[model samples]
Target chain A: MLGKFIAGKFLQYLIVIFLMLTLNFLLPRLMPGNPLVFLAGEDVGFMSSAEKEAILDKYGLNDSIIEQYGAYIKDIFTGDFGYSYQQKRPISELLMERLPWTMLLTGLGLVLSTIIGVMFGAISAWRRGTKTDANLLTVFMFLSAMPSFWVGMILVSIFSAQLGWLPVFGAESAWSNYSGIDRIIDIGKHLILPLATLILISVTSTFMIMRYSMLNVLGEDYIMMAKAKGVKEKVIKYKHAMRNALLPVATVFMLSLGFTLGGATVIETVFAYPGVGRLMFESVLSRDYPLIQATFLIITFSVVIANFLADLIYPLLDPKVGSRNG
Target chain B: MNTVLSVENLSTYFKTDKGIAKAVENVSFSLNKGEMLGLIGESGCGKTTVAQSILRLIEYPGKVVSGRVLLNGRDLIKASDKDLASMRWKEISVIPQSAMNALNPIFTIGDQIMESILIHENVSKREALKRTKTLLELVGIDGERWRSYPHEFSGGMKQRVAIAMALACNPKLVISDESTTGLDVLTQAQVIALIKNLQKKMDLSVILISHDLPMVTAICDKIAIMYAGNIVEWAPTEDILKNARHPYSQALLNASPDLGNPEKEVVSIPGSVPNLVNFPNSCRFHTRCPLAFDKCRQENPEFKEVRNGHYTACFLEGVGNHG
Candidate 1:
């Protein structure tokens, strides 16, 4: 049953990627004016007519639509995302340079937020109606309501500008000549503000979801049965109750993971962090079609992949889904 | 006879928005070893509340105001947290209602049963597994099918698994709180029969809480009839059947359709259960009791023994055939 479910999901995601690829091919072409003109750069005005046709031939844009589409699909599979004339670099290379920074920032943020949020949420639900629960709820309510960029500025102003304890902007102190551990330390210090901003905005949603789910699970008959069985208090809370409550949170975690990988755009902009989100923002402004298409394609694919992982994991958490599904 | 559990003067109240709802008021009963006592009551008569209060499982808004739940002479109400934890499942366990949801959906049947055993006893997982298999077989399930999750089983099968889980650690007292409720009538009969068989074979003391009068009369050795949070009559099942002293008990028996006597009229009891919030200081069943007098409305009746092993709380029991 599990094998069949995986096969079904695999086929579904494959079709989704294929359709996305077709759209990616058409979006840049569908724009008014010639894509070859964008590819030729500002030199297009001085160039001969033969030069413009050469640019179109180089991209295989002069071929029939079906042939161009076939080559587009084949090129995507081979990891060839075309060239960015604006940056004078390959789209894939540009994306690769920025991917790690995004990964590190959002990766740390996702892990920290989920852990802290889920733990505190479980604790709050276990002690619902207490002063501690009420206080935490109030704080997270405010945190969740605040926008990410605004929170980023507030954190940056307080910790970086006012306190002078951390870097104000960018991922590192440029030209500081730091290396190894010293360079890592500089990056870490720079990371604190944006990571905090991301976590502040993201954590509350997980916390609320976990708390609501835990409260409902705590009231379930199985939880009562576990209590009657005389299971240890910690075991009851963590194992029986928390395990069951984790189902919804697991899905949320994966979704945020995918979105964060695509990049925390607003937070990244506020921090001036050199990540995929910053690159995507600039690429859009410059109308770097190849770069824009590549970044969007990566984002959509990552989101789909994350949701796929969630589907695979759901059955492990809930046994009923595995056998009953298909 | 050895008394396995004795609940004395147990009153559990729920703090509702209206007032303190006396869910279970002054409920008292004792079960002898190897015996089954059916706690019969109408809906909202605090049967489930009594079960929870005995186990001290009542949550917020519900408190056990006054009670002494003595399990084998040890007062569970006064037992410390550690002591209570150690005694649970080892000494007493419950087969909950809605067996469909009683077992964790994520865990296998064996793991759930083994958990209770491993918590209370010093045993290897292999030994626990062996015992779990025995329990499953004893409950009429295939021993090897313990790997199955709760959803894999039918409703009756799940109820059987619940019974198996309750008996996992060999608890002396097991409370089956309407565990057969959601099953079809045929499946209900089968589950009830399994419980009866287990009680006799294991010499287990059982409290079968249900509103099914005919089923209770057929299987239980004793019956306690509750009316509006109070047990109005307690006696041997035969005694309650032949000479029901409480008007409420008689009304309940009359209301049930007896398969043995299809010709017998099945009368429905009039009036819903009274709202227990700030109830008046008098016999709670006075409004529905045919023989109620000025005295019944003026004060609460005392529960006292009128005959050997027979008890009731009606003023008429003391008045000697006044009806």
Candidate 2:
């Protein structure tokens, strides 16, 4: 049964990738602007008719849309994303350079949020109806409702400007040319504002979700059974109740992983971080079709993959889910 | 024989919006080693609450006021949280209702049982697993089936697994709270038989809490009937059925559907359980009692022994007979 579930999930991943690829190929073309106009700009007089035709032909812009789509599909299978007209570089290389920074920020943010959120949620639920729980829940509700960008601005204003504690923007030190530990420290310092903003905005919502889930699970007859069995409250919460409560949270986490990657575009731009979101923003402004298409494809693929993982994890958390397909 | 568990003057109430809703009032019972006591009551009569209170499992808004629950002479009500923790599962365990849901879906049955064993005993994984396998076999499941998850098992098998998990520590007392409520008749019988066989072999005391009087009558050595959070009558199983002195106990016997008397009509008690909030000031059961008198309306009855081993809380039983 376990082997079959894993194989099914693997197949699902492949299907998601295929769907994402199709979307990536189609969505960019649906937009208003033409690639040639964006690339050549208003200075079309610089090129002769022959040179212009040759440039169009070389880039496959002269081909019929169907033929171009077919060629795009074939190239995708060969791991070849087309060259960027604006940057004069392969789309793959551009993606490779910026992907790591986005991952670092979002990945670290998710991990920190999950840990803190689940812990606080469990504590609050355990102490339900108490002043501590009431205060914590109120704070969580307030934080979750606050906008991420607004929080970012406030954090930057206070932590960076007023306290002089950290840098407000960018991924690392631009002037020092530092590497290793110093570079990591500089990058860490630069990350504080965005990280705090993401954490503050996310932790409350996730904690609330976890708190509700924990409360519901704690009310299950089995929890009462555990208590009757004389199991300690700590063990009951951490072992029996929390494991059951985590099912919904796991699904939410998987969904959030996708949203965090694609959704952080505005946050990246605000922080001036050289992540994929920042790159996508720049690509849109520069009308760089190759860069835009590549970034969109990556984001779509990441989302699909995250959802696929979430689907796969459902059965592991709930045994009944395994029998659903069978 | 030494008493394995004792509960005295236990009263549990929930502070609701309306008022203090008494769930279990002045309820008391004792179980000797290797004895099986059946707690039978209508729905919402606090039978389950009595079982939960013994374990100190009652959650917030509900408080156990002025009670002494002693396990092997140690007062559980006065025991510290740490003391209670050490006593749980090691001394007393519970087979919870909804057997399938009781087992964590994420873990294998073996892992869950091993957790119970590990909590109380300092043993190696191999040793704990060996004991788990033995327990499964004892509960009439194949020892090899321990590796399987709960969803893999049928309802009866899942219930058996729960029983095995509860007995992992070989606790002195096992509280089965509606353990067979949702199972089919055949499965229910089989599970009860398995519990009976194991109880005898392990020499463990058990508090069997259920709404089905017939099932309890089949297995319990002693029986207690609860009505609106109080023990209306308590006696040896046969004595309670053959010569019930309490009006509530008589009503329950008449109400129970029995196979031997197919011609007899099913008699349901006239009224439902009284709402805990704003319950009658006198006897809580007086509003529903058929033989309630003027005295019963004005004053609550106190528990008094009607016979050497039989007790009832009712003013109708004549004050002189109580002694």
Winning candidate number (lDDT): 1
Counting clashing residue pairs in each candidate, in order, gives 0, 0
Query: Which 10-residue window of candidate 1 chain B scores lowest in summed lDDT?
Result: B314-323
Candidate 1 off by > 4 Å: A1-5, A27-68, B290-295, B320-323
Interface CA RMSD of each prediction in angstroms: 0.8, 1.9
Estimated TM-score per prediction? 0.93, 0.90
Writing each residue's lDDT as its tens digit, candidate 2 over A190-309 gives 987888887898898679888999999988877776676667778888888998888877888888888656537767888888888878888888777667777887777778778877
Docking class of 2: medium
* Chain B alone vs. reference chain B, TM-score for every model: 0.98, 0.96
What DockQ results do all the predictions give, each relative to the true complex? 0.77, 0.50
lDDT of 2 by residue, B73-94 (tens): 9998888988897898989899
The regions of model 2 sitting more than 4 angstroms off are: A1-8, A33-37, A40-59, A85-89, A259-263, A285-288, A307-326, B121-125, B201-203, B319-323
